[model samples]
Target: MARFSEKKIVAGSLITLGVLFSIIAAFTDCSAGGADNYAHYNIARWAFHYPNLFLDHWGKPLFTILIAPFTQIGFFGARLFNILAGLTTAWICYLLASGWKLSKAWLAPVFVIFVPIYFILMFSGMTEILFSLVLMLAIFLFFYDRFVLSAVVISFIFLARSEGAIFLPIFLTALLFKRKYVAVPFLLTGFLLFSLIGQLYYYHNFWWLITKLPYVGGIGANYGRGSWYHFLEKAPDYIGILIFLFLILGMFVWLKKWFSSGLKLRSEIFTRLLIVAGCFWGYLAAHSYIWWVGEMSLGLTRVMAGVTPVAGLIALVGWSEMDKTIKSKIGKAIFLGLTILFIVLPGVLKYKSEFKADTREVVMDEVVKWLRESRNFDHRFVAHDPYFAFSSKVDAWDSRRIQYGFADFTKPELNIADSTLLIWDAHFSQNEGHIPQKEILDNPKFELVAYFEPKVPLKVLGGHDYCVLVFRKMENLNVDNNQLMIKLKDEQLKGNLVYSEFFDFEHAEPGKVPDQFVVQESDTFSNKCYVLGKDSEFSPSVLLTDSQLKISNEVSVGVEFDFLAEDQLGNNEVLMVFSVEKEDKPYFYQGQDVLAVDSAKWNHARYHFYMPEEVKKDTKVKLYIWDIQKKNLKIDNFRVQAYSK
Candidate 1:
C-alpha cells in the first residue's frame, strides 16, 4: 500500500511536469511551424470560419469541438489544445506507471525525454500529440472496465485520428478473458456509433468515404506487414537507442510470464501487444504497397507516435518482473545513456540552434513592420512557414505543396501566380530539388522584392526544416528613370553546369551541375521567386519601375548578387550591394540582408536585394555590411531609383 501511494505521487509529478513543460514551451517558438503543423492550421481555420462545415467535412465532431475554443485564438490556441492533450496523455501514462509501481524518478521525465517523437510532435503543433492523449484515455478507461466510457473515448479517438478504428478491436479483445462474448457488443457499439456519426455528417457522401478508405488501408499496410527486414532497419530510429535496449532487457525479464503466466494482466498484456504489433504490421504493409517512399515514411512516423505509450508501458512492466539486482544494473545503464543523449545532447543542441536562428518575435516583428510599411494588408499570401499564415491576419496559405497547379479550381480568375506573398524557407529549399528561381523571378507580372535570410545555417537534426524567406511584389512596372540595368558578364559567372555556384563568378558547361531553376523534391528548401531563362546566355533583365514615388527622385536600385572570397576576417567590410539615387545627394532609407552565404538552401553563396521605396530627399544613407567570410552569394536583382514625378 505504501508502494502504491509513493507510485501515485511520482505519477502525479510526471503529469504535473508534462503540463508545466507544455505551458512553458507554448511561450517558446518551438511549437509554431512545420508541414504537418499546417494541416492542423487548415483544420482550425475551417473550424473558425465554417464551424458546421468543419464538423461535417472532418467526420469527427468531438475532435472538432475539442479544438473550437483554441481555434478562436487561431493557431496558437490549437497548439494549446495539443499541449493540453499531451498533458492528459502524460497523466494517463503516470497512472499506468503507478499501477505498475515504477518510481516517479524513473518515469516522470520519460513521458517526453525518452521518446524523440513525443518532443518533436509536441513542439511541431500537429494532431499526433492530441491523438496520443485520446488513445491513452480510451485505453485507460477500457482497462478499468469502464466499457461505455471506453466506447465513447475510442469513438472520439477514431474521430480525432482515423487509425483508432483499426486498433480498437485489438483493445476490445483484452476483455475476452473475463467474458469472451462481451467483447462483441462493445466492438459493434463503438463501430456503429462512430460510423453513424461520420455517415450522418457526410450525409452518406460515398465518394468522400471511399477517398478516405485508402488512408486507413495505407496506415495498416505500413505498420502491419511490410517486411521484418524493414522493421529492423526502422526500429532503431523509431524507438531510439536507449529505449530499444531497455525494451530488450525488459523482454528478457518478461519472456516466460508474457507468454504463459496467469497474472492479472496476462490477457491485457497479450491483447495490447497484439494491437501494437498490428499497428506496426499495418504500417509496413502500407509502405510495401505504396510507391511514394516519402509519403510512407511520413505516415509511419505518425503511426509510431500513437503506439509509443504501449511500448513504454510494456517495457516498464517487463522491467518490473526482473530481480532487483538485474533491474538495477539495467536501469543504471539505461539512465546513464538516456541522460547523455536525451538530456545533455538535446539541451546543448537546442540552445545553440536557438541562438543561431532569429528569435520568433524578431521575425514576427519584421514581418508585421514590412506589411504595415508596404500597405500589403489585404493581399492573400502563401508562406513557406505555416506560422505566418496562422499568426498574421493576411490570407495566407501553405506554399509547401507537392502539386504545383496555381490556377484556382474554385475561381477561374485566380491562379497560384496571383498569390501576393510567397514566403519561402531557405532551409527547406536546400533539401528539395533544384528550383527554377530565375524563371519565377523573371515573370513579367511577378517581381521579387523582399527576402528574409537567416543569420546562420539551419542543420537538420531529425528530419525537420527550420528556416524562412519572404518575397513581396514590386510597386512599379514602367521602366521609368527609377530602374537599374544589370549585365551578367561571362567574367562575372563561375560554376559547374549542374548548378550555378555563385561564388566563383564563372559559368560551368551545360548539364554538368544540378539546375537551380526548378524544385525537384516536394519538401526541399527553395527560392520563392520564379526562375527565368534556361541557359546563362544573358536573357532580358527583370524590370521594377512603378510610379508611386514619394522619396528623392533618385533611382532606388536594388540588386541580388553573389560573392566568392574566402578569408573574410574583418570588423566591417564592404560586400558590394546595389541601390538607386537621382541626385548625388544622400537620402534616409532602410535595407536588409536579403541573401547570405550561410543559407542552407543555397547550392552556393547567394544574396537577394530589394528597396522598400525610391530614395527620399534629406535621407542620410550609409551602407553597412552585416558580416563577412561567407562565400558564394547569389544576387537576385537590384531595384534602382525612379525619377521623381
Candidate 2:
C-alpha cells in the first residue's frame, strides 16, 4: 500500500509538471515563420469547409483533419491539442521506463519535456509532437502484448508522417520474432481500414501510396538533399552531447549484457530495450537523406523531435547503470550532478531563448489584422506565406507555384478584374532567393498599400532586418499618363533630368532601328515608341550618344529607363551600362546589377555613374541598354541627369 501511494505521488507530480509546461507553451510567443507550420494550419483549416481535403500530395493531413474542428476556437486550441499530445507522449515514456523497472521513472517526463526542440515544437502547431505521441503509443502497446491495439495505432502512425511507414517493417519484424501470428491478421486489417479511410478522404483508390513515391522521391532529390552523416552532425543540437554520449553508453551496456548471457536470454525488458534502441537508430537512418535534418535554419532539432523520448530513455538507462556501478554515495552524487548540469542546462537555456516573442509571427498577425480591417472580406491575395492567407480567410494563390499572367496588368484567367493583393516578407525572399522588390516597386500595376517593420529585430533562424510589404495590383491604370507623369515629376524634382526621351517611335518602321539610337551588338526595333529586342539567340544592346552634355567630374550622373518584357521558359536579365569616350576608346563608367523583371509589366531600372577628373573636352557620354538574356523587352521613357552633393 505504501509503494502504491509513492507511485501515485510520482505520477501526480509528473502530471502537474506537464500541465505547467503546457501552460507556459500556451502563453509563450515561440511561433516562427516556418512554412511547414503555416501549411499544416492552412490544410487543417481548409478541411473544415472543403470536401476531400486529403487529395493533395503535399502533407499527410491526419493531424490537420483532427485539429480542423477545434480551429474554430482559434490557433490556441490547435496548440492546446499539441500540448495534450506532448503530455501523452511523456506519459508513454513514463510507462516504458516503469516497465523497464527504472529506479527513477518520474524523470522520464522531465527529460522528454525539457528537451528544448520538443518543448518549442509542442507550441508551434507542427506535426512532430503528435507524430511522437502516436509512435510511442504504438511501441507501448506492442510491448504490453496488445497486438491488435498496437497494429491499429501503427496504421495511424503512417497518417501522421509519410516516413512513418518505416515503423511497419519494425513492428512486423518484432511480431515475427515473437511468433505473434494472430497479430499479423490484425495488422493487415488495420492497414486495409487505413487505406479505405484514405480512399474516402482523397476520393480516389488506394493509389496514393504508389503515387506519393515520386513526390517523396523528388523532395530529397530536388530540395533538401544531404549526405548520410547528416544526423550525426546535428545530434549535438537536437540531443545534448552528454545525453548522446550516455545513449551510446546505454547501447554498449545492453550489447555487453546480451553477449555475456550467451545471446540466449530473451527477457522482455531486454527485448523492449532493443526495440527502443532500434527505433532511435532507425528514425535517424530514415531521415538522414532529408535536407531538413541537415539544414539548421529549418530546425534540424525539430526534424529529430520524434526520437527525443528515446534519447531520454537511453540516457536514463545509462544513468541507472552508472549509479549501480558507483558504490560510493559521494561519487554517484557527483556523477549525477555533472550529468544533470551538462544535459539539462543547455536545454533550459535554449527553451528560454525560444520562448521569447517571435518577431515574424507578431508581424504576420499585424498584417493579417490590418488586411481584414482595411480590405474587403472577399479580397483575393497572391502571397508568399500561407499563414497570412489562413489568418485573413481570403482566397490566396502561392506566388512561387502559380504564375500571375498579367495581360495589361490584369490576370483575366484568375478573374482579377479589380485588383489582386500581394503580400511578401524578408524571410521568404532570403530563404527562397526570390526577390520581387524591383518587380513590385517598378511596375505601375502594383501600388504600395502597407509596409511593416518589426519593432524588435528577430535574432534566431537566420532572421535579420525583418520586414513585410503589401501591394495591390491596380486595374485600368493608364501607364502613359499617370505612371509616366509621376516618374517625370519625381525625376525633375531631384534636379537630375538632363536628357529625356519618350521614344514614341512614331516615324520609325517596325523592323528598323530608331533614328536617335544606334544598335551596338544585337538587333533591335522601334515599334510605335517601344524599343523591342529582336534577336532571339542573343540579347540586344543599344547605345544613345549625348555629345551636347557636359561631363563634369564633381557631379554624379543618373540614367533611368522603363522596360516591359514577355514571360519565357528560362532565365532573363536586364543590364544598363554607362560609358564615356576617353582617347578614342569607350571607357566603362558604371553599370547596374542584373535586374529581373516580371512578365507583361513595365519595370524601371536605374544606375548612377560618377564622372572622373581625367575627362577631356572631346569626351562623349553614352548610355547602353543591355538586354542580357532577356528577349522581347519593350524599352521607352529614358532619362539622364546630374546631381551635385
Q: Kindly list the per-residue Cα lDDT of model 2 for residues 345-435, writing each as its tens digit.
A: 7877765665654667678888888876885434556565655665565532433323223332222223443466666677664334344
With candidate 1 superimposed using the best TM-score fit, by how many Å does residue 301's alpha carbon deviate from the native? 4.1
lDDT of 1 by residue, 1-645 (tens): 345665566557666766776665556555323444654565565665554445443334455667767767665576667666765676677675675466432553363334655555555456667777777777767656776676566655665666566666565565554464544465555446645655676545424533454344331332233343564465556556555555566555555555566554556555545544444445445444442443324334444665565565555554444424444767767755554466325422433333222444355456657776878755656543444554565443334321222343222124444446655444332233122333334434444445433222233422232334344434444322112112221112222221112211123325432245322333223232212222321211222323333333323332334322223322223233333333544333233333334444432223333333444543332232233334322332222222322
The best candidate by lDDT is 2
- Count clashing residue pairs per candidate: 98, 3
TM per prediction: 0.58, 0.66
